[model samples]
Target: MSDTDKKTVIVFTDGACSGNPGPGGWGALLQWNGQEKEITGGAPDTTNNRMEMRAVIEALNALNQPCHVKIHSDSALIVNAFKQGWVDGWLKRGWKKTNKKPVENRDLWEEMLTAMQPHDVEWIKVKGHSDNERNNRVDRLAVEASRKFQQS
Candidate 1:
């Protein structure tokens, strides 16, 4: 297959927070054929979930156009939400859980959905703090980004 026909992008992402609701950071690595990109950012006050979602958001947004994407993340909340059809159900219920409680990060979820709309995405769960090189790299990137805020 030629490069044009090979439009799949592979990504690995991780999020870290010093405290549940304290400074947080997100890291993402995107690989497409011969090209690779690493992206990271931090927030003064944010939850781990938000950072996790942000890693995906940033990665998807980095794409220049629609393409098939395989996303690897260590967050079960995110991986399960999509793989288990929870996200679909949430959208069907107007972003409410089965108990009718509003989603905690509706804005981020909505953003993720929008970022994902133009692409075919597959969410893959990776073991966190494991020996996976890319996962470990992103995890360190996230922690380093988060600690930047702690030092400030």
Candidate 2:
């Protein structure tokens, strides 16, 4: 099919951490039309939430054109923040909580918004270990990435 025919895409992402604040990794799969792409990355030491946000940011950034995008993630913290409209509140309040602390992962959030700016994007929350094949693949890739970091 032609490039214009690729008007919609599906993305699955997952993050893994050896410890809450230890080696971490992120993985994503993007499918458009009949084509598929996979992405994975790791950090020597990080938090799961950071990796979670990174997964979305990296996946969105990989798109070559603005398309209707459906992003699925298993992280409630990331999914709820966007789906519940809490991200808007955080943005309006200058990335600070009501208690006035700087928002965690603000950098990744900014990157995600920037990457998504050209696309119509929807965020969906999926149960991590159920029947979703792509999600399971990403989860395995993420864990593997994290494990590589640990091995080093």
Best-matching candidate per TM-score: 1
Clashing pairs in 1: none
Give each model's clash number. Answer: 0, 0
lDDT of 2 at 22: 94
> Stretches of candidate 1 above 4 Å error?
1-6
Model 2 per-residue lDDT tens digits across residues 19-127? 9999999999999879999999999999999998899989989988888889999999888888898889998999998788999988888888899888888889999
| Candidate 2, residue 101: how far the Cα is off, in Å | 2.5
lDDT of 1 by residue, 12-108 (tens): 9999999999999999999998888999999989989999999999999999888889999999999999999999999899989999999889999
The local distance difference test score of each candidate is 0.92, 0.90
Q: Which pairs of residues collide in candidate 2?
A: none
